[model samples]
Target: MGDTFSSLLELGGPVVLILLVISIAALAVILAKVFQFASARVGRHGLVRQAVTQWRTGERNTAAQNLIKDRSLSAALVRNAMDAIQMLDQQPLSSQERDIREERLREEISARAADRLFALASWLKALDLVTQIAPLLGLFGTVLGMIDTFQTLQESGAAANPATLAGGIWVALLTTACGLAVAIPVSVAVTWFETRLEKERAALEVLLTGVFTAGSSSTVAST
Candidate 1:
């Protein structure tokens, strides 16, 4: 293991070291995100169905209470809207005033959802940067290695060994391989995270819409 690592370090040079660090960081982010999602259990379908049903039945506060009991993004959004309605109900405001309050509450819920989702997604960009740059760095190392090999050949002329030339070419090519190694998995992780995030956003939107229109709609269907 040690020999293989030493060989990689020698072949890829500083670019390999940089990629190594980025790989570690990407791994950390992936793990953190995985844990966050796992702990939150942020599923949209079931919770939205349950909450929307209660909302349509005019059990708004009860729905909010049930959802808020669980810690998830969709629940938080529904809770925010429901809590807003409760607060407005207590104010004895006119119809226009109540509408304005509901709108403001909706905005607040959206902002909070955005903030939470952004936090969840923020580290993904770093992983993406690693995925993008690692290959470029590897290519850079390859170019440097090739340049060194040519320089060595020019200086040595007839004395240059075939084995030495072959070694240099392989070493140069190693960086590209290393870059791809680091990039591929991170890219996969980024894609998976993006898929999960999009699902969460869709769920939140559906739930929020249900909450906002619970009064007008007779049936709240789950998506």
Candidate 2:
């Protein structure tokens, strides 16, 4: 395997080398993101939903306790919003003051949700750049190889060998193949990661809304 890789690098030249480095980096980023999503339990929201249901039924302390061990982004935002609302309820404020406070709390929770999502989305742009440029880089390498091949052919004049030209052409095209190899997988990974992020974002919005709405409903029923 090492011999094959070295031979490929020799044939593909600097462009192939760059692509190899990029592929390794992209793989690292993908693995890291996978671990991050798993650790945060990105899509596993059953517990969070249960907590929200508890909150809706006026079991505020139980709702908060249910989420105490949850580490998902949605759980964090829900906890914060729940704590904020609980604090707001404890105060002796007029109806107008309560409305103003609730709006401010929502904004603060939204901002926090954005920040958490942003953190999850870190290093995504570098992968995107790789997807965009890998093919072009391979093409650039192929073009350079072709130029060199033709230059050699020109120097050979009448003695230019057809077999040599054929060999040169395939070797020149190797960079382009390598580029696509790097790019296709990276593109797919980026797409998957992006889809997950969007889902998480939507989930956070819904969960927070439920918290606030549930709190309001509970208040209305009591009054």
Best by lDDT: 2
Poorly placed runs, candidate 1 (over 4 Å): 216-223
lDDT of 2 by residue, 1-223 (tens): 9999999999999999999999999999999999998988888789999999888887888899889899887888899899889888888888899999999999988998898889889999999999999999999999999999999999999999999999999999999999999999999999999999999988888888999887554484594
The window of 10 residues in a row where model 2 has the poorest summed lDDT is 214-223
Give me the displacement of residue 133 in model 2, in angstroms. 1.4
The most accurate candidate by TM-score is: 2
Looking at model 2, the pairs that clash are: none
Give the lowest summed-lDDT range of ten residues in model 1: 214-223
lDDT (tens digit, per residue) of candidate 1 on 1-223: 9998997787678988988898888899999989987776766457656977788777766677788667776776777777776676667677787778778878988899898889888788888898899899889989999999989988999999989999999999888898999999999999998999998888888878877876422223331
In candidate 2, position 48 carries an lDDT of 96
Off by over 4 Å in 2: 216-223
